[model samples]
Target: MAQDSGAPEPDDKLHDECGVFGVWAPGRDVARMTYFALRALQHRGQESAGIAVGDGKTVLVRKDLGLVTQVFSDADLAAMPGHVACGHCRYGTAGAKGWEAAQPHLSTINNVIIALAHNGTLVNFDDLRRELIDMAIPFRSNTDSEVAAKLIGYFTQRGHRLRTGIAHTMRMIEGGYAMVLVRENALYAFRDPHGIRPLVLGRLGDGGWVVASETCALDISGATFVREIEPGEIIRISDDGLRSERGCRPLTPANCIFEHVYFSRPDSVKDGSSFYLMRHRMGARLAQEAPVEADLVISVPDSGTPAAEGFAQESGIPFGTGLIKNRYVARTFIQPTPELRQMGVRLKLNALPDVVRGKRLVMVDDSVVRGTTSLQIVRMLKEAGATEVHVRSASPMVTWPCFYGIDTANQDQLIAANMDLEQIRSRLEADSVAFLSTEGLFACVPPNGYCTACFTGAYPVQIPRSFYEEKFLPGYEPNNLAPASKTSQMTLVQAEELLGQEG
Candidate 1:
């Protein structure tokens, strides 16, 4: 939905692209299982929700522009009985918005049908789309996800197995992605070579299997977490049992570090540690690095609560709630009147005067994006009688844009990209402002190769020159940490020859 001309600006934070889930279980209500899983993964996206089920004969899909609960009624789930299914909830980063762009994108290859849900941006999709269009392939949406589904279908129809088609397609797409696909009789899951986006494998009751973008989805669906889907790996689950294949050669691991700082739910576990623990550690580290004298440490709200608690514990300050969020205020189509528009952040959050009055406050938030929301929040705290409001970010300053699944602004709109620490503090009108150091952020998470591009301006994948030219300002340049590996971008002829050799 387009924002009204006079609507209040959105919160200054990065948005993740989407969440994907797949399940393969006979005798289970696969549709309902997917529905619940999508609910758990809802935080990853809110623009649209969809589910596709393969009932042993044909793939059936239902999708629309709304939250998961808004899109799927109990009756809708009951209507889509199947043994295998895939679901998607999307906040589109690489496509136009509308019902057409809602995913679990469906396509046909000969007599076979498949539905796919994807969770990242494809940096080279524009070129690939043009290539496919030149080949007379039809397209329903401008999303890279549709390109993927059709690309897989195109390869499959040319006398290749579905898994091989998927493998070949994986070799062609460039960017951070985790995808879940469902055909009439099986479920497939795959990830990009760098593992820049997350996908987890899980075991359902004795005979079932599940894959999702996060462990929280698996938890809600009564699935036990097994392990992460390896980078460049393809997982196929069918009646014959589970199969895993190396769809492409794995490159240096570059998992998105933001997952620990903000994206994943605090309760979600990664590398044997809960995100909550990692964020808490980040808070402690932030406190050590940027200590301040304040009577109370308060969080921006739900996302910042864990870090705020740790900050309080480490600094020996009392932790209290100075701001209360209106839980029911989600994205709305209804435009607020001019008076309400001026209220801005107040529509979603309100200051607790009884808690903050006359106290010096240290307010911790997960991150600072454009700084507009932070400025309003600081003003609100002061208006509520706080003597001072110190803003602390648990994550490092986001100085660069993300071309992966995250919906970050161009460099010009990112406050950190344009301002130094002192300038940012002045801009936000906060008594003080501090961000966690990049090195400190890395210390809090598990020891694994991570994508710190947003903090360091070092990209793991080679962005298309066109994309780079379009996204970066004139004076800015990016550091290509690792370009696309040779084997990752296979030619059609090479892919065909390899498939023939396997045959």
Candidate 2:
């Protein structure tokens, strides 16, 4: 959505939470340090901020709806001081955007209590919620994070200790998740078996240990990057170093593709691949797969620039700006209505008449979900006198709601999921439109791993038979998305062949 840089335009709906940070030490002002960590992660989320700390035996939490700076008065931070702290700045995507559902959920079971903060989602949330309700489990907040906490509590009654309880929760969990849990004197860091989510370990020179969703946060906290928590692995950390264990069962890793494409900081290195380099390669791959003749190439904005560069390098097309974005516009995608959305998009981006006038332009965007912004940008380019506009997407067309934490788009809300390319091009009113093949995207990742279910409808884990809004029949066979009658499915062998072809 476009909005005047000087105007404080308000948006609702679209939000991205910044990140999570946790630190454990025998004794210190951990809450004070948590405030600083949240400050550094401020870029990831701006809607609400919180800090929950445990001083070995007691857990104290304070969270509210607002920017980190707005929520943390010096008094507020110091008033809630402790030695072990877990902090979150949330942009509400799945749960109610109210204070009641904020992160650092506290729950107790079998007389043991745990305070949990998580990055990512549980694929089996609805089913679990239903089962818990059936068993008369009471719930206060409507959030998957809370659900996770409750699941751990539920399993604790089955005679599992903290580690065993966490392992049991892991067995119940599906989809992308990296969670940090504080129980008693220890901090536990665990990743989903599929490794769809990212978890990083860092060490403070002063014998402190921190676990966070990304390495960038660790750097900001002056913690040295230890390593990525492996997929299907759990590491329990305390002052006595770390004792790593594995998930009871293992699943193949399928890291979310959008992390490299849009979500993560360019400075972060997920698994083993550089986020910046992967995105740059995505652009290059897009150009190689969908090259077209145009007078010049322009990216959607900052997110599109790296790939745009790659596209230019590979397509031999001179890249230049046809549109200029106001750098100061703050969070306008929050607009509640279509009229406001269009207005905001126009306000954020204005066409550069001098550069684009009478030129054939190729535009690159990271991904298109609602198509509202894409249409507005297209109209702006036309109004700027671009004779022809060709649109290319760096990532494959998003065809499904991310079951993981991303929550990018819903099944029916996705234009690509429901429409063919020709229909989308016509709807967006572009001279031409192209999407990177799923195979093209496979070649984009550095082989760290990928979850391409958004484009391929091939979930890394089995999804629930039903959502609250939609009922899916478990008996119904999946749509078998293989290329032709010559195939049963895009098996690993076929995917490898497609990857080779795209490369």
Candidate 3:
């Protein structure tokens, strides 16, 4: 077993915002089910975990900064006795990372307690926050999800029902989101107009209702997969039954393509297609586009496994596990210092000398962000006696920042944006390197149904110039006094400080 190098692998890939799960089951242990379901969707986030359980008359929430396993204990789950529960696994996209930023943000609306778990980013959070703060609404965190919850609460407190408040809130917010909210007596789940995030509804064998970010959560909770919650639709569940209503008319179906390429767990299915199968198809497409002659095909396990299998099968090459991952090293407490990061790759994955001894290798990975990790992998394989390493990527090169809830907003940090394919291959010490074509990616989803903004620079929504500069280049002030774009407005932090003080 590879011992921990005293640090986790530094961030090398685009990160999804979060994962949400909610359950409404009167007789079942909804809290435990939520915990298990969140455990299944942990891949979506690792920064924080939270669970909010609501009985008929009261709601209790517990959240903290850590992995789900580290945040909640058996005693904690047992203490949360309720018929309704909402859980979240978070990786902050719109807010500064902190313990207080954990989700299932709780608020009171017309004295009705609302606890919400969100899995997307909102572009107009700053605008919405300005509106709410003007109404004297107090805020506890800087996250966009909290802004959204407050917007809904504001309307609910003004004589509107929960459903109507949510509808109005949806109209005011823009961007990608899949949300699950629990009230004192009922549970509500909804998707944004664009459906850039994934949310699915499932049925438990014991007459319970489950909603989650992926079907894998449903499988873990012993629930049968139900249909996906349509974009612009809101579903409410209570003792009476489940009811759905259109929250807003969808502009277009802009599902995040990264979900299929890298975010989702392989065992999970989305849009009637298995995530693993989609990666397999991407690999096959890569094989057809960039053919290579190698003795063996190896994956950068475990995200690289499906694509490598597809590459090997399509190319008629033998597939083998050339790298062994230290599963326990996934979420380590080790600090990611410069020295530790250089050693982190070796600690997470070690080359199998026996598998690659004197073999020409075709290595497949989901995608590359900085190329440092890829360089380390190629170096390790070469040190283990691999004659050659041909690197292949399953997704097209990511050259633009994602403003719809992914953590790839810095173009300078993106290796592909700064280097050509040959330059990248030279940096990684690979014999050759190739990425799947954008056309190949479009083939993986329904026509005009996916967002490839990061790869093609075709943003589905307008972005503010300040937003881009804030993520890509800090400390540089814009000379123009006007906003960056028509859609690019102030952020909540800026809006709060600028729109007069609120104590």
What is the number of backbone collisions in each predicted candidate, taken in the order shown?
Answer: 0, 14, 1
Q: What is the TM-score of candidate 1?
A: 0.97
Scored against the true structure, residue 460 in model 2 reaches a CA lDDT of 72
Question: How well does each candidate superpose onto the true structure, as a TM-score?
Answer: 0.97, 0.85, 0.91
343-369: candidate 3 lDDT, tens digit per residue: 758878999999999999999999987
Off by over 4 Å in 1: 1-8, 487-503
What C-alpha lDDT do the candidate models reach, one value each?
0.90, 0.73, 0.84
In the range 150-170, model 1's lDDT, one tens digit per residue, is: 879876766468988898888
lDDT value, residue 268 of candidate 3: 90
Instruction: For candidate 2, report its TM-score.
Output: 0.85
The residue-by-residue lDDT of candidate 2 on 157-189, one tens digit each, is: 553466665766676656568788876667788
Off by over 4 Å in 2: 1-18, 25-29, 39-44, 109-113, 134-136, 157-160, 332-342, 468-503
Q: In model 3, how large is the Cα lDDT of residue 146?
A: 91
Largest lDDT belongs to which candidate? Answer: 1
